[model samples]
Target chain A: MSTDSVTVHGYSTSGNCHKVRLVLEQVGRPYQWIEVDSPNGATRTAAYLAKNPNGKVPMLERADGAVLTESNAIICWLAEGTPMMPTDAWQRAQALSWLFFEQYSHEPYVAVARFVRGWTPIDSPRRADLPRLIERGEQALAVMERHLGRHKWFTGPGYGVADVALFAYTHCAADGGFDLGKFPAVEGWLARVGRTPHFVPMPLPHDDVRTLLAQH
Target chain B: MSTDSVTVHGYSTSGNCHKVRLVLEQVGRPYQWIEVDSPNGATRTAAYLAKNPNGKVPMLERADGAVLTESNAIICWLAEGTPMMPTDAWQRAQALSWLFFEQYSHEPYVAVARFVRGWTPIDSPRRADLPRLIERGEQALAVMERHLGRHKWFTGPGYGVADVALFAYTHCAADGGFDLGKFPAVEGWLARVGRTPHFVPMPLPHDDVRTLLAQH
Candidate 1:
């Protein structure tokens, strides 16, 4: 690991965790990855909560003991001064737009859907919201499809944090029971992001995500 | 208007409105500002809604006629390729972390509180939510105070989109009936953002936001 490196606390299969790791790999930064279990209440521990009051990962711990949480924020900080950010103001905003889209329009649906389908059992109470969640998730994907049709990337011409933000779960959306074939543009965009140099594949969670779901 | 520049839709007083304007001024870009009224349903018209299906302002219309909405996203697009984005991967993440913080933690409290207090009439039914809103708003401010206690800027020394994201409502937080004096660090940070060369103030909406809220 590089001396000035940082450590990321996250579960292997988490989309948010994947977002940070992708940046680390792309930037060629030397950082250690420490797996933290979310299902087992790993984030609720006092030590983890101290790092992030919100009790979410992936959290970045700098050498100075300062810890940062929120996957997109960590990527923005890491990609600053790099080519990851657009050169133009409008382009930059576009990048942020997609990120916001991911959080508000996308994550609430896609991320939560994954939790329901992959983290919870079929008969679990959380599964009650699955249908609506999946429908909303498809709407989010529809938004992505419209945008990806024009731009080669989320912000245009290059793979930036926006791509990273959307790429996290989009590739694995099928596992959430999303029929990825319906969103051809999003599928094409996923292929493009996967082709980026130094791109890292999201690791399969220790418990096969499907297996975890079956238990739920 | 600067030749070949961009155009922004929405009134200045809007928190999202300020985000786009802040970056334009910060980056020295020449862009035309077009005022659109959301409260008055100006954004609901065929022409405006055609540009953004979401019917929100703070829309950035590019020279090529592509329109992008969502204030934080717009600002990030602007800040890209500038020093506003951190150089290191970790630093970039920090910036996004704060941006997310602004959206999830700060905006819901500060911005929503403002809507409840400043935009709504004192005796309006919305007032019932104001006390709880203010209570939660203070909690958000406390989080910011704790973070700002150590760092000069939300992401670090150099200001980034995260600052813009948080700054939009923070400066106008008082109008929302928030006690600005409660958080000195946020106050200082606001002053610093205000001092940035060429920084522009958000113009209050033409139709009183209060009247708009009463209608709701």
Candidate 2:
């Protein structure tokens, strides 16, 4: 860790949490990670809730104890004044627009579908939502596909925070039973994102999650 | 409208859309408003989809024909360089965190509950989700209550974009069956937001929707 390193409290396998790590690594910022087993009531602990009343990960805490929550917001802050965030006002607006879309339209469906499919039991009633989640998730992917067809990045002219934000869940979309093959543009974009400098893949889920994923 | 004015295509009654109008009004930025009847398929038209693949409002269009989407993103951009957006990097990050929270944690439930109750038929199957929506919406309210107990605003030291973003849905929470009386701090903040310069209330839903809300 560097003298100015920040700390990230996150669940390793969660895409929202992985987003912070990927950006920090890519930006070459030193950081420490404290894994929070969010699914097992870890984030609900009094200590955790005191730090983040919203009770979720990944959270970025500075040495001074000022903290930032919300994955997109954290990355945006980490990427500011770097090439990871656009400097042009209009381009920055475009990047922020995609960030909002990911949270509002993409993640809730794509990420939630993956969690419901892998984290929940086979007979879990939430699994019944797969079809609707897939449908909505597809709408989001198609929108991305349309954009990737004409542009290389969500942040103008480069791989930046918006790409990082979307790629977190998108690369693992298959876990949610989504067929990325249907959207060739998105697949190509994902590959392009994978090739960006200092990029790191999200860690594999633990044995329990993997077994559940395999069983289903 | 001024020579540099932009246009907002939005459904008048939607809180997300209303956020754009509110910030633009408060900033005194000249803008043209084109009412989009989102729930009735106005946004689904091919012409609209060509401009915004996400097919949602409010969509902000520049005079040069460029466009920006996502309601929170729109307000952030509009408020940039104004007192409504913090100039300090950390304060900006905090404002953004709340903006993401409003979309992900609050609007999906609070705003949707209002929609299900008022826009859908009384016998519509979506009403079945209301109990769950209300539950989740209350959790979001509790988080805000906790935050407001210590801070005067979501944005540091002032009412800004985050406050506008949250007030969009929270002020109308009663329409979603949310009881503001339970969250006194949040109620106070809402009243403070109402007194901001040029603050405008979201347009009342039409008679058809009002009748459904009254029936419910």
Candidate 3:
């Protein structure tokens, strides 16, 4: 545990990958970012697969070569003992509740729906799946809107890993072709998370984010 | 925090609901079980919806009227400060990582696939979506198979909440048409979690699990 170095293997353009980098920045932890080319099949390589058989991005390599995957898990590990994780048992469970919601209720619709809309052009062969994705995506947003209507953050009064996990892909959901204007509460909550110090935009190509951020 | 009375609102047939009961029984926590009939849309009532807007089952009602929903989240909360939660940060995060995987990569496929196959007839309208569900379901199982191939448990060396989260639906996934025999590692794990004290078999209507246990 004496080693001060941390290396993250993921693409900068990935929302899940950005979750780790953003937390590291927030915690003021020093680490190196090794951009894994996910598009080019870098994760599927034998060496990388040995580290994580799932072959997904956002793999964290500790100084001990003890590899960890799953974006929220890595972030929570880094945020432990800090103000990021609430000390109370129930509040921690509340945080985990949101993290679970992010994966179950939110990501399946918001993230996958985004992929359907943004990654594939309207004329692509996959366009047929768009309507169902949009329907479910809207349902996910409605759930978030209802919750954020009363609370400032997902877990408690303060920002925690829940905010970070949900914030990653949600801020960019419109790019996936779902209208953000329909969810006013989610929009407001997104703005609140953005105002936090050390808040980093989801990883995208520099020029694209530069343009997107300019519009904001 | 001194209140000891705990009540769970759920149905016996639901794996999600069963998970909360399983944990409560395992921890030796005294609690009352209140049934919610999803088949009759009982959870959608205004009374139940206030408890959880998602209208899902397995909601925990603390003695103070504070309600907690989501099976995984509730289990973690109930298990907190107990032997189930790992004291170390990394091991805890690993527990959460698997929980996230269960929700994201595992549950969506296995549980939903089960809902489609088990709840609906073979010629049901939902069967149209079966191929996509089966494809993703098999993929998720493959990921778990690979992970279990290396580690004994999902997180710590001992069984923890991660196992509880995955164990509930996975053991019953055969009802959803998944061939459990193909995944030998997961089969071995099923045997392992089954050996734990207070292990309860899946409940059926008036099935008398205790009587069945005595017979076994």
Candidate 4:
């Protein structure tokens, strides 16, 4: 990485964090990655909290000490003035709508389910929420399926930050117990996203965690 | 409203919808409000779904037929080049981080608890989720409190969309059984938001719903 390259603090296994890495790669931006193991309490340290009071992973820090969190916001900043972001104001707003929808509608259900299954102990009370999470996650996937039926990308006319944002959790939905077979259009879109130039898949969960998720 | 003004479709009592109205009023923009009774199913109609497949209200329609949904996204577009938005790219990213945090970390807990208290029947099974929701909502509030202890506004320098986005549910957190009195800084921040020029309070819930929420 160049001396002035942006620095990203993230956890490799987190879809939220991975989205930033995906964008940086796709846009050919040089950046340094510092792994912050959020699930294991690394983000709670005073040093980490000093940088991000919110204590979430996927924080981007500039050389001048300016910091930006929220995976989609960082991606938007990185993709600005590139084809990865739309030029028209209205289309940009539409792209943002999808980004918001992904966080509010999709990630809460899907990503949380994956975390509950893989990261938490088998007897944890959060596992009880699985059924509801799966049901709600299906609804979110159906919305994406309906959108993809008519449009190839969430951002008007091409793949962009919205697509990257949604794809991060969605391509891994099966790990959350969501069946992609139910939404052919979404499946096709996921393939399209994977085929993007410089695209990198989210790192796989550890073997023991994968075993736990499978058993669950 | 002027002939060229945008039209906003929203439910009066919804914090998400009210955020849009608050921004438009604060910015002195002329816009028509079409009350869509989202709680009573207006937003779920085929006609409404045609405009927004997500079937949520607070959708803005331009005179030329373009539409934008997502309250924060709408406000950003409306506040573009205005004091309500940060002109610096990094500050803009900071504002968006708060917006995403509102939707992801804050709204799901605070807003949903309020909805459950007011909109659901007294004995609804969903009421069982309130304790967990309150616990999580309080955590979200604490983050805001900490931020308020240092910064005057969520948007970098002044009252902006992030402030508007957070204020909507936060001001009414009491309706969800959250005692804002616990967080002096958050309470003060709420007052600061209210004092912004042309600020408008969210509409009160209907009498029966208010009584229901009060009992809870």
Candidate 5:
């Protein structure tokens, strides 16, 4: 696939969006990135919602006008038939299980907390939910810690999209008030993911959000 | 694959688990069902957690000891090469997007509200969340309503796992205090899914939970 034929609409700071970028980068697939400022009402715009009724990012648009949404789904499509996706059906299912885990179990708590802390004002009423978010996020981290104790990668036998899916939110979980120090195995796994070839870090939150993150 | 070689550990009331059973039934694959009462601490047991580190129900186990969790992944595996899964890569990605949306956007609100309303006492503090859950669940329903208005099914030109994934929670969304009267298109889609070959409805919640649900 030609890099210029694919366009990704995403907010750079979002772990969900960053997961797609990470996979594309790791695979050396070039694509255009259109910044969709989700936190500031961009995604909810009628124009954006027309593209994705769910009003979220990142969204992939092909040259033929075909569109695919959901971060994990997009990354899976980008990495199809590559080393990033397991060829074995059972292992692929196992990898997809972790992808679902990242979205359902891990991201909701960890990523939402990060969004709340960084994007909202320090005294925003939403901040009140931080304690519960942190607790739940820790539980998710614990699950990863246990898995990492016995396995080197979330995808069977190698680094792949599952690791990328997980690493997106997990590496930034501390910003959500999670104590990564308590989960050494997860910390090591995060390091391993970061050291993978062609790895690119999620960009820093924009300046205004960075200021709020620091205050929170 | 012989049905005798498959075992599914699940909570009958959970939409996630029920999606797996619905697919197995639709596909005419008979499998052993081990009822794990998740809300009653069944999934948290050390034995159950050993089989699924995430400690969630709807786990698929093979005779060879391989296990897969995450309802969408399990259903996709069960539906592989069948009409339930799209053969075209774009349609498959689109189906997966709905699966992700079902878990992230839809289930968290719709399914959780149903669990709270059906399992908790009317006066329980969790009931306080019902208003918010209803609001968000409606948003998810609206998205589905918009899509169903244009497409008869979530997957391209046919009913598939995406339909099953959304149907598991959506068909029972009224239990979560959502008034389906507003979403005519979605209501029609649900009925269409019910008429699919070999369809099976989710089992009713248990007697005590029924009492709680009635009172709520």
Candidate 6:
């Protein structure tokens, strides 16, 4: 086992998992990817649960057997000593703040809406949550619009981890029924993030999920 | 205005706000506290929204007028360069992993349960969310229990910001209808956190809220 490479257990279509791959590709880190069927209960198995008590994906395991969980935390650790994370204390704090905001305020609404829409059965009772999710998701987008209006990036002076974390879900928020055109500044920022060097997009979902996403 | 100290604007009974204060006190830092009525409409006012467009309490403002939002972010920043925050890169990453888990997996369910039960009207529709919140909150506590059964603390071999972050909501989880007695390991860890140096408890809620908490 080479300690120089890490292994990531993740579901490819998941934005949270995809962010780790994006960061690894951006920074040219050596790693192996093991696709977990997240929506199909791969993450819920006893073996997986033993490794991550929370039973979530995008888990990173070093060759030396040390494991790290949480996509943002994994990327941040991979970005350490790299320009992807700010060197200044206060700037680092702001970046971290955006990260927390992305997970708490943004993902719970935006990403979950996308999941319920694209992944669940078309008539799943979860569809009832769509209206509230979209409402709350738009509020998060407005907050991003306000910030992007004055500042170009969530990470200090650059397109960095916060951008990666937010982009994972925000880029595909339309699948969740969000109208991105309403926030011109956020739309502009999204394009800018896409244009960054070594940028990689999340893989498309299967045809069934894609069709569901397009239907509504 | 002197830039020597930071001021925290927060609701007194909120666990998120109290974590910031606990970190500051533990670090022996000079800071000012401003109370905000979060359950009311105070966080949504034009003045409050100007500083924080997200319209949340537990905002940290430096004397220079620079403001930071997000409870975990504020406490991590305050704990930086102190024993409260680990210096080693890998250890810091582990600590951060716990911080993210506390917010994403834990707080939304645990803290919101408490808010719904204790602060909302007896017949408020939000009370309907308590059962689901408590179920999810128990999963989080179980994860903590599994960890605490093996490790002394969440912050990488010591009591640190991760401890403070998890302690915020976990200590008062009963108000959310969680049975901490099921997690003996977690209960022991909470006691250890309370015994830490310069530890201070969260302020109690108003009489009406307290009465509401005890009724059901």
Residues B44-87, model 3: lDDT tens digits: 89988877887788889888888887888998887776777787
True contacts kept of 6: 0.85
What is the alpha-carbon RMSD of candidate 4 to the true structure? Answer: 2.1
List the candidates' TM-scores in order.
Answer: 0.76, 0.98, 0.90, 0.95, 0.97, 0.98
Candidate 5 clashes between residue pairs 3 or more apart in a chain or in different chains: none
For model 6, name the residue pairs that clash: none
Model 6 chain B: worst 10 consecutive residues (lDDT sum):
B1-10
Write candidate 5's Cα lDDT for A1-216 as tens digits.
335558999999899899988988888887899998788899999898888888888999988877899999998888887899998888888999999999888898999999899988888999999999988888889899989888999988999989999999999988887889999999999999989999999999888887877774
lDDT of each: 0.79, 0.92, 0.79, 0.90, 0.89, 0.93
Q: In candidate 2, what are the lDDT values of residues B1-216, reduced to their tens digit?
A: 133799999999999999999988888989999998899999999999999989899999999999999998888888888899999988999999999999999999999999999999889999999999999999999999999888999888998999999999999999888889999999999999999889899989999888888875
Model 6 DockQ, alpha carbons vs. true complex: 0.90
lDDT of 5 by residue, B171-213 (tens): 9988888899999999999999999999988889889888887
TM-scores of the first chain across all predictions? Answer: 0.94, 0.97, 0.89, 0.97, 0.96, 0.97
Stretches > 4 Å off in candidate 4: A1-3, B1-3
Per-residue lDDT for A1-216 in model 1, tens only? 244699999887889899999989998898999989888899989987777876778888988897888887777767766788676665676687778778776887788888878776666898878798889889888777877777788855788889999999888887777889999988988988889899889877556666865453
Question: DockQ (Cα-based) per candidate?
Answer: 0.45, 0.89, 0.67, 0.78, 0.87, 0.90
Q: Relative to the unseen true structure, what is the C-alpha lDDT of residue A130 in candidate 2, on a scale of 0 to 100?
A: 91
Which one is best on DockQ? 6
Which rank order by DockQ, best down to worst?
A: 6, 2, 5, 4, 3, 1
The residue pairs found clashing in candidate 4 are none
Q: How far is candidate 3 from the true structure (C-alpha RMSD, Å)?
A: 4.5
lDDT of 1 at B4: 51
Error of 4 at B65 (Å): 3.1
Q: Distance (Å) between predicted and true CA of A99, model 6?
A: 0.3
Docking class of predicted structure 3: medium
lDDT of 5 at A210: 79
